[model samples]
Target: MYQQNGEEIFVIDGHVHLWDATEENIDHRGGEEFIQCFYDYHTTFTPEDRQWDLDEYRKYGPDRMVDDLFATAAADMAIFQPTYLTDFYTEGFNTTEQNAELAAEYPERFVLNGTFDPRDGDEGLEYLDELHDKYDIPGVKLYTAEWRGDSKGWRLDDEEAFEFLEKCLELGIENIHAHKGPTIRPLNRDAFDVGDIDDAASSFPELNFIVEHVGLPRLDDFCWIGTQESNVYGGLAVAAPFAQNRPGKFSEILSELLWWLGEDRVLFGSDYAIWNPDWLVEEVLEAELTQEHRAEYGVEWDVETKKKVMGENIADLYDIDIEAKRETFRNDDISQEFGLEDHYASGDPAPADD
Candidate 1:
C-alpha cells in the first residue's frame, strides 16, 4: 500500500510470473530467444539503476520475487499468471505447480492463476480438473501463440477452446487472461491478433476476458472491441511500462482506453521481473495528460481515476474489500516485521533497502 495526499491506495499486481530460463533449463533455441526478447523489453523500459544482470535475469528465484513485490515494492497483493512453455524449457517455463508453492506459503499476498492449452485435448481437460482440485484457481492464462509440435497456434473461438472455457465455467473459474500482444519468433504474427477475442467474449458472457497487453500495436482494434463488449477487459502488463520511455504514446493509449472502456475496466499490472511494480506504481500515480490531450480526448486523469487503476478496479473484480484487507495488513506480523506500520503511520516512503 502507498499513502499519497493522506489517502491509502491498495495495489494489486494483476500479472506476474515465477519463471525459469536458466541455460540448463533451455531446451532449444526458442527458449534462449524468448528470454532474450524479455531482456530487450527490460532494458528498453527499465532505468539503468534498476536493471538486473543477465545471470540474475535468467533465474531470480522466489526469494527475490517475494522481496521485490511484497516486502519492498508497493504491491499489496499480486496474481500469478503462469506461462508453461514445455517445448522451450525442459521442465516447463513457469508452471502452476511452481507458483502454487509460493502462494501456499504466503496466501495473503498472492492469488494463484492456472493455465491450459486447448490443443492438449482430453488430457488437458482432465489436467484442468486436477489443477482446480489442487489450487482452486479463479482464472487461467492462455498463450495462443505457444508452439506445440507441428501446430503454430490456436484461436479462442475454436471448438476445443470453447470446450475448455465451458469446463472453466463449470469449475467456477471466471477470468480468462489471454496473451494477445506482440508476437515472438516461431509463431505467426497473426496468431497474436485480438480479433478472436470478440467472438469468445460475445459467446461466453459469464466469463471475463481480460486481454493481456491490451492488444498492443493493435490498440485501435482493441479499443473498438472493448467499446462493444462489456465482458472484455484490458490488462496493462506490457502497456503500463511505456509511460517512462514514451510518455505521449502512453498517455494517448491510456486516454483512449478510458474513453472507450471507462475507468472500472482498466487493471494495473507490472508484468514483474520484466519491470518491477514499485516504480510503475509511482509512475502511474504521477502520470498526467497534457491540457491539449485532455481536451482532445475529453478524459480526466485525476486522483480518483488513479486509485481505481492502481488497485480498486481489480480488487472489486476479485471480490476483495479494500478497507478490510488494509486492516488485515495493519495487524499482520509481516507488516510489523518490515516496519510497514511506521512507514504507513508516518506517511513516509518504504525504505529502499528494507
Candidate 2:
C-alpha cells in the first residue's frame, strides 16, 4: 500500500511470472534467447541502479518476488500469469504448478492463473479441469505465440480454443488474460496479432478478456476492439515502465486506453522480475497526462481513475474485497516485517549485482 496526498492506494500487480530460466532449464538456444530478451527489456526501461545481473535475473525465485512485490513494492496482491514455453525449455518456462506453489505458500498475497493451449484439444481441456480443481484459479493466461510440436501458434477464435473457453465459463473462470504483445524468435509475428481477441470477446460475452501489454505495438487495433467490446480490458505490463523512460508515450497510451475502455478496464501490471513493481508503481502514481494530451485524446487522468487502475479494478475482477483485504494486509507478517509505518517510505533494499 502507498499513501499519496493523504489517500491510500492499494496496488495489485495484475500480471507477473514466476519462471525458471536458468542454464539448466535451457533445452535449446531459444530458451536462453527468451530470457536474454526479457533481460534486454529489463535493462532498456529499468533505472541503472535497479538493474540485476544475468545470473540473478535467471532465478530470483519466490522469496525475492514476494519481498519485491508485497514487502517493498507496496503491492497488496499479485496475479501470477504463467508463460509455458515447453519447446524452448526442458521443464517449461513458468508453469502453473510453479506459480501455484508460491500461491499455496502465501495464499493471501497471490492469485494463480493457469494456462491452456488450444492445440492440445480434449486432453488439454481435461488438464485444465484438473488444474481448476487443484488450484481453483480465477483466471488463465493465453500465450498464442507459444511454440508446439510443429505448429507455430493458435488463435482464440479457433474451434478448439472456443471449446476451452466454454469450459472456462462452465468452471467459473471468467477472466482471460491474453498475451498480444511483442513476438520473440521462432514465433510468427502474426501469431501475436490481437485480431482473434475481437472474435473471442464477441463470442464469449460472459467472460472478460484482458489483452496484456495492451496489444503493445498494435495499440490502435486493441483500442478499437476495446471500444467495441465492453468485456475487453487493457493490462499495462510491458507498457507501464514508459511512465519513467518515456512519459510522453505513456501519457498517450493512457489517454487512448481511457478514451476507449475507460478507467474501469485498464489494470496495472509490473510484469514482475522483468521490471520490479516498486519503481513502476511509484512512477504511475506520480505521473499524469498533460492537459494538452488529455484534450487531444478527450480523456482525463484523475485520482479516482488512477486508484482504479492501481488496484480496485483488478480486485473487482478477482472478486477481492479491497477494504477487507487491505485491513488484513495491514496486520500481515510481511507488512510488519517491512516496518510499513511510513507507507511512503519504501523499506526495500537496493538490488545487489551478483
Candidate 3:
C-alpha cells in the first residue's frame, strides 16, 4: 500500500528466513542450516516447530514458510539469498541440493548464497569455488557471533574469515552479509558491539560487507562504519518483533541510520520465520522517509530511496536484471506456481497489520 509520484511502490527485502523443520520435512532438507536457523532463532518457534523431523514440518505447512517470503518480498515476484549456520554441517554450511532445487525450480526468483566458515578450512575454499563457478551465487553470508554455541562466529580479523573475504573479492563477488547474532546475550550480544571489520575491509577494498541488526549500543557506531567503508552497509529485520511490542524504540534506530548512513548504504530485510514481514513493513510504512536531503541521493523522493534499499539496489548488485528475469518468468511455467495467480495460496501476514 505504498506509492511514489503515482508510481506504486513496494519492497523486496534482501534478507528473510523460511524453515519448516517438522518431522515430515526433517528428511525433506528443503533448506539446510536454514532449518536450524529458524528454530534456533525464535525462542518460541518451539521444539516441535523447529524439529527438522519431516512429519511435523508438513503439519505446520512446509510450503507456507517459503511461499510466504516470496509472496511478501515483491508482490509481483521476489529474489532471495538463503541463510545458514555451519556447526551441524560436517563440511560447513554447504548449499544443499534442496537449495539448488529451489533456485532451479524458481530460477527467476530465488538466488542461492553459500556460507563459508573457517571451521571448514581449505575445503571451505574449494566449496566456495563450486558456489562461485558452478552454482553462480552472488554473495557469501557469515554470522560473526556465537549463535547456538557456534564457534564459527570467529571475527573476520581471525584470518580465516578474513582470508575468505579476500577470496570473495578476488572472485568478483563484492557483497557479503553478516548477522552479528542477537542483540540479546548468551548468543552474540557482544558480537554486535564489535564494530566494522576494518582490517578485513581495508585488505579487500573491493568487497562490500553488510551487517544486519544494529545490535544494541552499537547502532550509531554501525552507522559510522557503513559511512566510512564504501563496502559496508547496514540492514533491518528480526528487530520487528521488538518494534511491534514497543513501536518507537526501533524508529530511533531507523531515523538514526537514515540520518547517519543515508539510504544508499541502508537496506531492507525481513527476518522471516523469526518475525513476520507485516511486523516491520507496517512500521516502515509509518516511519518517516521524507527529508530535505531527499535530492542528495539522486532519487526524486525518499520513497524511491526505500525502493532501492529494499530491492532495486540488491538486484543491481547481483546484476540480477529483475526486469529481464520478470519477462522470462512471465512466460515460464514456474511463475504461475509462485506468483500473483497463486499469491494468496499460502497465508502471508497482511501488510497493514502489526
Candidate 4:
C-alpha cells in the first residue's frame, strides 16, 4: 500500500513476470532477439539511474524480484502473467512453472496465472487442467502471436481457440489476459491485432478479456471494442511508464481509456522486468492530466479514479480483500523480511472504544 497525501492506496500490480532470457536459454536466434527487444523497451522508458544492464535484465532471479516489488512497498500485491515461448527458449520463456516457484514462496503477496496455446491441441487442454489442479489459477496470459511450428499465429475467435476458451470456462478460469500491444521480436505485428478481440469478447460474456498494453498503435480500435463489450478491460503495462518521459502521451492515452472503458475497467501494471513498479508507481500516482486533455476528454485523474485504476479495480477482479491483505501483511514473511511491518500497520483500522 502506498500513502499518497495520507491516503492508503492498496496497489495490486496486475501484470508481472519472472523470465529467463540468458544465452543458454536461447534455443533459436529469435530467443536472443526477443530479449534484446525487451531490453530496448526497458531502456527507453526506465530512468537512467534505475535501468539495469543487459545481463541483469535478462535474468534477475527471485530474491531481487521480491526486494524490488515489496522491499520498498511500492506494490502491495502483484499478479504473475506467464509468457511461454518454448520454441525460443530451451526450457521455455517464463512458463507458469517458472513463476510458480516465486508465487509459492510468497503466496499472500502474489497471484500466479497460467498460460495456454490452442495450437497444442488435446495436450494443451490437459495442461490447462493440470495448471488448475496444481495452482488453481484464476486466469491465463495468452501470446496469440507466439510462433508455433510453421504457423505464425492464431486468432482468439478461431475454432481451436474457442475450444480452449470453453475449457477455461469449464475449469473456472475467467480472466483472459491477451497481449495486444506493440509488436515484439519474433512476434508478428498482424498477430497482435485487436480485431479478434471483438468477437472473442462478444462470444464469451461470462469471461473477462483483459487486453494488456491496451492495444497500443491500435488504441482507437481497442477503445471501440471496449465500448461495446462490457466484459473487456485494459491493462496499463506499456502505457503507465509514459508518465515519466511522455506525460502528455500518458494523459492522452489514459483519457481515451477512461472515456471509452471508464475508470473501473482500466488496471495498472508495471510490466515488471520491463519496468519496475517501485518508481513507475510513483510516477503514475503523481501524474496529472493536462487542462486541454481534461477539457477534451471530460475525464479527471482524481484520487478516486487513481484508487480504482491503481488497485481497487483489479482487486475486485481477483477477489482480493484489500483490508484483509493489509492485516495479513502486518506479520507476513515478506513484511518481516523487509522490515515493513510498520508500513502495513499504518493501514490498520483504529480501535473501537467503549
TM-scores, each model vs. reference: 0.95, 0.94, 0.73, 0.97
Stretches > 4 Å off in candidate 2:
186-189, 341-354
lDDT of 1 at 297: 87
TM-score rank, highest first?
Answer: 4, 1, 2, 3
**C-alpha lDDT of residue 96 in model 4:** 93
Off by over 4 Å in 1: 186-189, 343-354
Backbone collision count in every prediction? 0, 0, 14, 0
Report lDDT per candidate: 0.85, 0.87, 0.55, 0.91
Residue 122 local lDDT, model 3: 93
Candidate 2 on 227-246: residue-level lDDT in tens?
99999999999889999889
Put down candidate 3 lDDT per residue, 179-266, tens digits, no spaces: 7545322342356654546666667777777776644446666666666777777767655444454445555556666667676777
Better of 3 and 4 by lDDT: 4
Estimate, for each residue in 125-183, the C-alpha lDDT of model 1 and write its tens digit.
Answer: 99999999999999999999898888888899999999999999999999999988876
**lDDT at 8, model 1:** 61
Cα RMSD (Å) per model? 3.9, 5.4, 7.4, 2.6
Q: Is 1 or 3 the stronger prediction by lDDT?
A: 1
By lDDT rank, best first, the candidates go 4, 2, 1, 3
Identify the superior model by TM-score, candidate 2 or candidate 4: 4
lDDT tens string, model 4, 183-220? 55434348658999999999899999999999987899
